[model samples]
Target: MLNKTRGRPRGNPDTKARIAEAARELFLERGYKGTTVRAVAAEAGVDSALISYHFGSKQRLFGQSLNLLCVESTALDQALQGDQAGLADRLLTSVTSLWDATAPTENRMALQDDDTMRAFRDYLESELLVRVAEFLGGPDATERATAAVGVIGGLIFTRSLNPIRSIAALPSAEVRRIFGPALRAALHARARQH
Candidate 1:
């Protein structure tokens, strides 16, 4: 029985947005491990080939799945540029709270799953760290800030997988109690040397 429910229909700009939006919603819900390109195409009400045409490939689509770096990077830059006295407290709270259940565990797993984390690492090291360098001071700050961000980000990424490993559940104030002055002094001292 050849059932012809051909998915060919006239799609507009709005329709394209809907398709991408549907794919993103379903992907995050079911996960990259579970959702198929065909399924996303179905949910989006477009041809599977359209998904490929628009996004190129599933891995490329996944990268476009969210716009996160803008918020993540901006928050840190803002905190770093803010009043020095409460800087670490603000940074800790921002980083900790941002990590809480916001990123789907599957997204982190997506990194390990695809072998593209190296690409992402390189991008972050070059682009993201460069932005941090400009915001904090200059090139000298890049190395230190990149390493520090990596440590904090890695810790949070780990905590995402193992809920019990998350000591972030502690009050931001408490976490800041230890991390605040020490980090602030060091970074502030680093900045002042400019």
Candidate 2:
């Protein structure tokens, strides 16, 4: 016989957001290795288990805390699902759509915030780049992921922050048409081994 608890676990409706906010503050202050799940829960005034329930692990909580850096996994999956040659186009379209949804002012502000930018890099390395490299599954997958992200990061920065008139004035489709081939080349590059 097992002792069973009845009903779903009860928590504040805002528990997830609260936990994430607390986590972001701590992570920015202490860096990834220094921040603890217990500290985040205490900051948020939630139980430690609630953080696990909502985010699964500290790494995931870190990713969520950097919400501004997120790209929907479904979107990335959809982009990667198609023909090999179209991968760059699909990915650019997916990412650009998300960027287009946010106001340029918001993008600029987020990019300018040193703490937020650091969080973005952390999320890119720990989450996005790792997932992309694993999905590619080759000896050079990490290299390809790095190149792809570099290209995309440059595109985002030029469009949102520095605002190169030539790049920024063009529509997303046109921008994709011009840059997609370069991105595709980066994505498909195989390292020349000695």
| Highest-scoring model, TM-score | 2
Candidate 1, residues 54-151: lDDT per residue as tens digits? 76665455556543321254455556666545655666676666655365354455455333344445434555455545666654576556655564
**What is the Å distance of residue 171 in model 1 from its true position?**
5.0
Query: For this target, which candidate reaches the highest lDDT against the unseen true structure?
Result: 2
Every model's TM-score: 0.49, 0.74
C-alpha RMSD (angstroms) for model 2: 4.2
Which regions of candidate 1 fall more than 4 Å away from where they truly are? Answer: 1-74, 84-87, 101-107, 114-116, 161-174, 189-194
Candidate 2, residues 116-143, lDDT tens digits: the string is 6776666566666776777677799899
What are the lDDT scores of the predictions, listed in order? Answer: 0.56, 0.75
Clashing pairs in 2: none
Error of 1 at 72 (Å): 3.3
